[model samples]
Target: MSFSPDRSQASEAAPVTGSAPGSASGAFAIATQGLSKRFGNRTAVDGLTIGIPAGTIAGFVGPNGAGKTTTIRLLLGLVRPNAGSATILGHPLTASPSYLPRVGALIEAPAFYPSLSGRTNLEVLARLGGYPTSRVSELLEVVELSDRARDRVGTYSLGMKQRLGVAMALLPDPDLLILDEPANGLDPLGIIGIRDLLRRVREQGKTILLSSHLLGELEQVTDWLIMLHQGKALTCGSTRDLLAQRGELVVEAGDAMQLDLVARIVSEADYVVTREDRTLHIACPATFAETLNRQAREAGATNLTIRVKEASLEQLFLALVKGDRS
Candidate 1:
């Protein structure tokens, strides 16, 4: 997708001093340098540095125990870093008050009174947060909870509750929104609902930092990506550029002998090939698919089929983590 954040609605961003691989050149909504956090002897985050450009949806991707949550906490000031520094919306980390007002977050599961109606809940929160109650109806509509606005929270489904949580986070009309696993416990349709909602939110010129294990969904929506492993950032930059780095051509044959011959043809061409049953996975650019097909045919391999496949977020993450381990 295209990223075009309305600068008029966004804060004045700082000039880019450095760039991450494949990242766009612009001011960062969030930037960190050597940000670290530890609990006892276990390091939750280690020497992490990243830049999330202003007015884009950046995905926070990581496996279990990969410090994704810790990093979010540190960024939200729920937990302080052991070392390093960060800036949010041009304000230093130490000055959270200056930036927190313009920021909204839905971390983990959202909590609400079970007996209260969804609209009432938001109204209460808006009043307590010193925000006008007029935003309640608009937010309810935005989250698609207006139909169920009068229903008690106790009767709402998991998806409904999640949507309500999002509405709560958005009460302040924040410039930057942070969401952690908003799709958790949601069905496929629910997930799609959240995805559509996020795009609509982004259309208003707001920046979003989304953390989720749903890489496939993230791959579709995120303009930038920050991949984490074992308390460190393995990669951070544009999602398209990173995925473009790796691609494969799958060549299949009617028989094992033909597959071997096709594999040999690709291997002889100096492309790395992995044999799996009757398929040859050749590590090369998608553009090489035509050449591979022709070469396999020339090698007397009939009934050959070749398909170009791009590297998915899951594939890239597994490859990077494996490389890091090695």
Candidate 2:
């Protein structure tokens, strides 16, 4: 249950310094400054700076081709940065070649032998990585794969494979875990399962960097967020702080005609509205709810119900991205 390693070892002598510019010393599990990466004439990540504080589940989200993967690679030292630098577990990425052992990563779909049992696959990885064999069982239990430990990976579901991949990553008992698209192809139940798994990992005091396109689900599991648009950070802050920035009032009238009247009144008030059936969703302040109700009643909107709706992460992300492009 303990991930803290003895820092007295020579390989661990110089932990990542807290002296990086713009990063709060000793507050982050991962920190990057002006990080940039390029492929020939194309730029993938551009001046991306982020600070993920220690022991929190931080989400990395963006549209396709937004350089999320490249940024992850840069943090893992899988590729050299064209400009800028990063620190993982307090060790400068390029300087602390030995720091990788303290980190666990599943960058993409992990390859496993379909013919081998799940446990055997993990054993192979552990042996190759010089990880202790005792960890194989421990990780299997942690990922809830102990029941299927002896089953052939070929027979496992996509969710199972993803869970197995997580188990492999935990084989080293790393303090920092970086997962790219961990819930990429899961059903609703599978997504929730992974969410719960991540919660458990956080409870164990491990810092997790989860990258996924499923913003709604990602919102459920993360406390902090880093949203990328076109390889640049659109926003970075706590999940609640970002979502609470926007509020909406939802009004449902009795019928379509009532909705139309209500919409006209709200539009007259100079607020944007989106209609779904008999409900009008307005992105406005909560204080406007009373005014909307009064306007709806004055306009003869019967059976009207008004309530506040918090902006969802998807809504906020889309709005930010679109606003940036504009």
Candidate 3:
């Protein structure tokens, strides 16, 4: 895996991974150039080039077996890319695993000794990882586990355990945090807790790459998106670009003769209409959906159903994957 951070020299970063001097607009906190991974006859993640800007959240989304996990592993240097390279903060990812200190990752489900207290467990990991003891309290509070610090980790609920994993990742005060399904299997409160914690981390100018199968949850947190389908990057860009849809109104009436009359009134005013399923699929501002619904009644059109077909992330994903297959 070839990973370079946005920074100049990665070693300059404190205990963990170093920060890139120039901002993400300059080099991008996470850069992957043609990154790919393969397993014999099967290709898990193919030729992926993506960039995650610092201080923002980038959602890596896909369904089961979409290779989102493989990509995350490659970025963390746990698995080497077969074809391309990636860098974190300008430092080559495969060059040194120690550079990971600058990064905190919640990969897979993390576990601790069943008998260890949450606080002691963190203290042990923190000391072993070379992070200051001060980080333990800070992270426990961040994950909302401070109140249960003295309890045995095994006694904690699944939600608490997951939160503790997140706390461990945050121990080094990493600049780039990678979380894969951080909200999995949590209650509404736990999900909201993770969401709020990520927001706080982002506010501190930390960059986060959050991966999840829950599109709705990600839609709530990310400013950008890198959608993966069948191990390839299907679409990547600002969320606004993906969500924006454009078109016009086409009204359909059971009586074609009557509909033609209405079309002519607007056609003379420089408008065109097309008919679909005996209903007109028009090109018009979505704001006018209600207006058209009301206008069709006065215009002598009956049984008018205003169905707005706007493109959404889910829709776009389907189109891209289907397009690829075809």
Q: What's the true lDDT of residue 255 in model 1?
A: 88
* lDDT, each prediction: 0.82, 0.81, 0.72
Candidate 1: tens digits of C-alpha lDDT, residues 41-93: 99999998889988899998888788988998998999999999888887888
TM-score of each model, paired residue for residue: 0.80, 0.77, 0.74
Model 2 residue 9 CA deviation in Å: 47
Q: Pick the candidate with the highest lDDT.
A: 1
Order of the predicted models by lDDT, top scorer first: 1, 2, 3
lDDT of 2: 0.81
Clashing pairs in 1: none
| List of clashing residue pairs for candidate 2 | 16-90, 16-91
Q: Report the lDDT tens digits of candidate 3 across residue range 1-326.
A: 11121212112111111122233534577877678899898899998877777678888889988899999899888888889877787677777565687899988788797699999999999998998988888888888889999999989998888889988888888989999888888888888888898898898898889898887777778867788888888766555445432224445555776566556545554444676656665543334455455555677665544554444567556756786311
Candidate 2 residue runs with Cα over 4 Å from true position: 1-23, 249-307, 324-326
lDDT of 2 by residue, 87-201 (tens): 8887898875667998899987988999999999999999999999988988888889999999999999999999999998888888999999999899998898889889988
Clashes of each: 0, 2, 30
* Whole-model lDDT, model 3: 0.72
Root-mean-square deviation of every model: 7.6, 10.8, 11.1
| Candidate 1 weakest ten by summed lDDT | 1-10
